[model samples]
Target: MQITASTVSLTVDDVAASQRFFTTHLGYVEQAAAEGFASLARSDAALDVVLLARGTEVLPADQRDRHASGLILAFTATGIEAEEERLRAEGVEITMPLREEPWGERLFQVTDPNGVIVQFVEWVTPSAPANA
Candidate 1:
């Protein structure tokens, strides 16, 4: 059996800004956009997002956290430090420092302007030294 992750849903407060961030920084292409929603695609992967304008919903502001916690979405990176530096150069906030974990993965965290946390990780794989 085989499984492939294709899409996920994210709630953002701004449509155009989020779209720009995703397309410009994350390399996602816009597949669709509407009054308050957009679907962006990244190569074979895609994200289904709904931009909820202020005062359009009836729920209290605090309740939004109910489903927003503990979701770790990781994007594999070639050089975690290099990626971190590039993002920092672009004026994006880096919430966590890059560090190698006990599991041997170099990982870091960044919170998007809309409050979504993105984790960047690169697996530790041994290979012949560059001099070889």
Candidate 2:
């Protein structure tokens, strides 16, 4: 079987607080939510995510190793610069300014309030070869 997509699960300290930050700041729509868990999706992409409850036995026994660099999600965008500008204007903390990579990708990054880093990229040229 071929793998389709991947999902990254995050254990947040406060579900409602994080939910609001995602919905209001990042523009993610609530797909599902409860006291213990929540799922949200960005209106512009197929990316979906779920947030798990923290501070329980279900949580990892070791909390000292928790980190922000643990995960990085990359997304494709149509207008990289404009989107970055908009996000910056809205107070989005840009970790890395937009730059074109040697592989022809214009990309930038931002971190959510909970410290989840997301990278957004737009291709500079068509990359599709022959087989589709």
Candidate 3:
């Protein structure tokens, strides 16, 4: 099957809080919203986001009360250093400081008002071995 797009649905205690955080800080615009639900999107290829209030009936009974946790919604981006600095300058708390891994992945994270972890990542060329 050909997939046209992607979206991440997160269940939070306060949908409005997460909605404001995403739209205000993450460059997402509201596609639609209701009393306890909101759909957010960006012009870029970034995945769409849907925030749902906990215990919303749209979800099945078994999963209705489960809040989003234990997942880091990571987005691959460019110029992450500058992005991090810009976020800092805008008063966004840096939950995870920017750091580079030996395998060439550089990443940092910020926690939303509802405690969702959003990470931005970039990749660089790995260093050659000294013996090379």
Candidate 4:
């Protein structure tokens, strides 16, 4: 199957908060919106983001009441340090300070108003293992 686009649908308690965070900080534009739903798009990628109000009828019966939890929406980014600084200057709290792992992944995180965790990551060349 050929996929032309992708989207992550999140059930949230406050659609407006998620909508504001995406559009204001993440460079997403609204494709569509209604009382309890929003479709967001970005020019740089095919990944779209959809926000649905928790308990809204638009979701399946079994999923309607569930809010997004234990999920970290991550974006692979360049110049992560600069991005982190820019976000900090914009008053966005850094839930996880920028740090690097032994495997060569640099990342940081921020939590949106509704408690959704968004992370930015950058990969660097890993050092050769001692036993390699």
**Candidate 2 lDDT over residue span 38-111, tens digit each:** 88887564577777766545556785234434787788878879888988998877999999876789999987
Q: Supply every candidate's count of residue pairs whose N, Cα or C atoms clash at under 3 angstroms.
A: 0, 0, 0, 0
TM-score of 2: 0.74
Off by over 4 Å in 4: 127-132
Specify the highest-lDDT model's number. 3
Q: Give lDDT tens digits, candidate 3, residues 1-132.
A: 999999999999999999988988899999999988999999999999999999999999998999999999999999999999999998999999999987899999999999999999999997777788
TM-score of each: 0.71, 0.74, 0.96, 0.94
Q: Which candidate ranks first by TM-score, i.e. highest?
A: 3
Compose the digit string of candidate 1's lDDT tens values, residues 103-131.
66889987766666778888895455658
Residue 20, candidate 1: alpha-carbon lDDT? 76
- For residue 71, model 2's alpha carbon misses the true position, in angstroms, by 1.2
Ranking by lDDT: 3, 4, 2, 1
> How many residue pairs in model 3 have overlapping backbones?
0
- Those runs of model 1 whose alpha carbons end farther than 4 Å from true positions after fitting are 1-5, 44-70, 125-132
TM-score of candidate 1 versus the correct structure, residues matched by position: 0.71
**What is the TM-score (0 to 1) of candidate 4?**
0.94
